[model samples]
Target: MPRPRRQTGFAQVTPNLGEHLDREDLLAALRAPDARVENTTLSGLELAEVSADGTGFSNVAFRGCTFEWVDLSGCTFSDVLFSGCRFVRCEMGRSWLNHVDFHSCSAPGLSFAKGRFTGVSFEDCQLSYVDLSEATVDRLAASETNLMEATLHQTRLRHVSLDRCDLTRATFFRTSLEGIDLSSCEIAGIRVSSDLRELRGAIIDEGQAAELIGLLGVRIKEDE
Candidate 1:
């Protein structure tokens, strides 16, 4: 099989949305088993503790919506756009996302473990403490996002870009960073394996190199 195409730039998502749906209609659609909500737009809705597992959303746009403690595990999202949305403690494990774009969203403590992502991009999002463990990610781009203290253990990433993102104290156990660039991102206090093998073949600036060196109990002194 041919290799997957690399995603070099930001995600270009053009949702083919149709009629606007109110909160009641949206909730009703989500209640159905293996639901597939298509071509709809829902905005400015505040939902809490919603259980909508195994649902699929296609060509949907959610603007300024707030989701708290929502369970959306095993869900599928394709060609979906989330703008200015807030997801607090949302459970999205084992979900599959394709061609999804999250713009200016705040998703602190959002759990996406064991998920599969393709052609996804997050721009100007606050994703602190997000969980992405054991996830398979391809063609993903994250720009100006705050991923501080996020979990990425055992995650498989291909053609992923993290531009100007804050990865402070993020854990990456058993995850490889080969061919990934962290020059513009803040990677202070990132956690990895003791052998430091995860950082092999990864691109970083001089300052980042110094920080990694410090992890190996080595200090660099400037020339007199």
Candidate 2:
């Protein structure tokens, strides 16, 4: 299969959403054997512990919604936009997201292992303890996001850029980060999980280099 095209830049998303729902019918959808909600707009609702595994969401807009411990594994989201949504410990592993935009969303402890993201942008989101291990990402832009304790093992990050994202305690094993710049991101205690050779051609600032100095087998000494 041919490689997906790289993203040049993200376009501003302006959704002319349909229906203004104060409360989502999401609870009813979850009770079904397999829920698939399409072309809906959900906002300002709390989806607590709902399960939508293997569900499909198309042309959906979720704004200011809070998903608490929701099981959304194996779900497919296409043309979905989430702004200011809070996802706490939500399970979304192996989900496929196409043309999804998550602006200012907080998704702590969310698992998206082996998920495929195409034309996705996660701007100003909080993604702590998130798992993207063995995932395939094409054209993903994550700017000003917090990715603390996240793991991206053997993941393919093609045309991905993470600007000013906090990567504290994050692990990158067998992941190619070449041509990616980490000058403005926080990498405190970030584990390579492999040899430092994977970071070749990656850009980092002087401060970040100082932190990784020990990894290069260079010892810091007191000034004489």
Candidate 3:
């Protein structure tokens, strides 16, 4: 049996200052070494194969942007807002995100392995087939989102709230789902390679547990 995780919460998470500038200068900054962009608002930008690894961005707002095959691995973001952004097959492994909010985004095939997210909220987003292996998330809120077939191997969830999310066929192997309450989310076809101990300390409603009877190999005999 796994030890019960302590109840944890994230408080006072806010974005810091950022540099307010145009789109061309932001592109130029990304090309420089140790680039750090802060307090900037860039919109309607289209980028492909952009490398944003290990860069620092603070209080940056991006809207109506599209990224294709872009690599954002190991990037650090603070108080950033992404609205109406479409990420197609982008790589975001080992990134650090704090106080970030994503709204109305379509992020399919977004690789986010080994990432750390705190005070992050996703609303009305489609995140199908996103890989989040070995990630740690705290104070994360997801609402009206679609996460079908998303991978969550060895991920840790703390103080997370999910509402109206569809998690059909989502993979969860060796995931530490401590302090995560899934009372209002739709969880169907969730594949778990490990035993039920991996779901210890998780809060689920009765209907959700009944949906997981097949995973538990339980045979509920009914009277004829």
Candidate 4:
């Protein structure tokens, strides 16, 4: 993919991708791992795969930033807004996210294994084949999002709302959906079992609904 045009904003330049960026630059700017960067805007900043696991950044804003193949696993963020950001095949395993909002972002094949999330929302984003296995999520909301062929193995989803989202060919092996609300998501070729009661609020097509019903003890009557 071609790089986006450089825009001016409050961001420090770091090394190219695959290289480690200096942490001093970020520290000198008083951008602590636990700092609150609310309402500030950052654009056109390309940094290397940072290893700032457990770093906390709240209320920061990212616009048009390209994070091509960055390893941002286990980073903590809250109330951060990301618009027009491209995270092509980035690794974000086990990241701690809270109240983060994403709009118009493409994050195909992004990894969030064993991560902890709360109040996270995604709108108009493409999340094809994303891996969110073993992640702990709370109050997760997705609207008009694409989640084709995503994996959610052993993930704990409590109070998650999927509205008008595509879940074609998604796999949910051993994933708990006790309080998840999939009322508005397309449930085509989705895998689930009888014990998973979260399907109460899940929306599905006729074929998909039949599959779920089969898992239960109910059988559809055929025309004689």
Candidate 5:
């Protein structure tokens, strides 16, 4: 038997500043009712065990921040940069990350279902178990990133460049992967389409070779 997933704690938490102070000193601030942060630079801060919902964060630089077991549902972030940040068991359903750059971040079990991202760059990031199902994005570039076990069902990926990314065990049900390169990627257990041969320019390795040969009407037998 496995434990069921619990809702993030930030849903019931909020940031409270006991004394009037700047955003840096506000790290010690208690949880607020809504936890709305604006125009704040919370760089290199460790935010743990907080579940946030409907929180609006804009123009924030969250470099090297550690967020664990956090939920950011319906939150809107713009011009935000998360460099060297780590997110563990984070839930960000329906959140909007417009023009946000997540550089050098490693996140596992990060859910962003039905979210919208525009002009976002996921450079050198590890995105495992990150669900982007039915999500919409524009100009999203993921360079030197790993997307192992990531779900991208029915997601719109236009003008998205996944250069040098690892896509092992990634799911792409009913998704269009035209004009995308996967040659520098690992696609073991990847869910693709019949026209995935068009992505031969992007996929690399023996597994893809075998699959592509099979798609090309070539048969390989144990005894030739």
Candidate 6:
């Protein structure tokens, strides 16, 4: 049961939001050579095929926004909040996220490969088929989140907490689960290393143990 570190001093900057931005304003900002936007809120915008690579966002709140085929690779986000947002086929590889929180967001098939995340949280979010391969995550907390069939191959996780998360059929190949407690998570049909070294030092309930024991060619018989 790793205790995730919460974000601090974020409220001080977020409360003083400057103004609500529109879709045009957001597009203009993203087009800049070194885009950096802060203390603003962008809501209810439906965008598609937009590129915001290498943009920096701080103290920004995106509410009810929908992004499809968007490229946000190499972007940096700090103290950002995403609520009721939907991301479809979005590219966020190599991005840096710090103190970011996502609530009621859906991001299926989003790629976060090789990204760096710190003090990030996802609550009641749908993240199925999300790719986190080779990503480095620290202090990440995910509660009541759906991560079915998500790819976490070779990802590094530190001080992460996943409570009541649906990780059914998720792939964790070559990823170490040391010190991670999956007692409350649905890990049925999860893919791991053939040696099962990834499960070393991991904590799981008896039912989950029964689910995993089959991978070792062990069978359990019911008592008559």
All-Cα superposition RMSD per candidate: 4.8, 5.5, 5.8, 8.5, 9.9, 3.1
Off by over 4 Å in 6: 1-13, 16-18
**What digit string (tens of lDDT, one per residue) describes model 6 on residues 66-136?**
99999999999998988899999899999998988888999998898999998888888999999999999
- In candidate 2, the residue pairs with backbone N, CA or C atoms under 3 Å apart (3 or more residues apart, or in different chains) clash, namely none
lDDT of 4 by residue, 1-224 (tens): 76333222222222221322233554333334543333355766665554443456655677777787576776777767777898876887878887778888999999998998887888889999999998998878788889999999888888777767898878888776555556557776676655655455554556666766766768999999
Predicted structure 4, TM vs. truth: 0.73
Q: Is candidate 2 or candidate 6 better by TM-score?
A: 6
Clashing pairs in 1: none
Query: For this target, which candidate reaches the highest TM-score against the unseen true structure?
Result: 6
lDDT value for model 4: 0.70
For residues 77-96, write the lDDT of model 2, one tens digit per residue: 88888889999878888899
List ranges where model 2 is wrong by over 4 Å: 1-14, 20-25, 31-35, 222-224
lDDT of 1 by residue, 1-224 (tens): 76334333333435455556788877886788887887777878899988994898887888899999889999999888888999988999999998888999999998999999998898889999999999999988988899999999999999988888999999999999999999989999999998998899989999899999988999999899
Superposing every Cα of model 1 onto the true structure, what RMSD results? Answer: 4.8
What overall lDDT, based on C-alpha atoms, would model 6 receive against the true structure? 0.88
What is the per-residue lDDT of model 3 for residues 1-224, given as tens digits with 9 covering 90 to 100? 66333222222223442436776776677677668987667778788877764778876888889988888888888878888999988988999888888889999878889999988887889998989899998778888889999999888887778777888988878886666777767778887764776667777899888878878878667789
Residue 201, candidate 2: how far off, in angstroms?
2.3
For candidate 6, give the lDDT of residue 31: 78
Better of 4 and 6 by lDDT: 6
Q: lDDT per prediction?
A: 0.88, 0.81, 0.79, 0.70, 0.71, 0.88
Lowest summed lDDT across 10 adjacent residues in model 3 is found at: 4-13
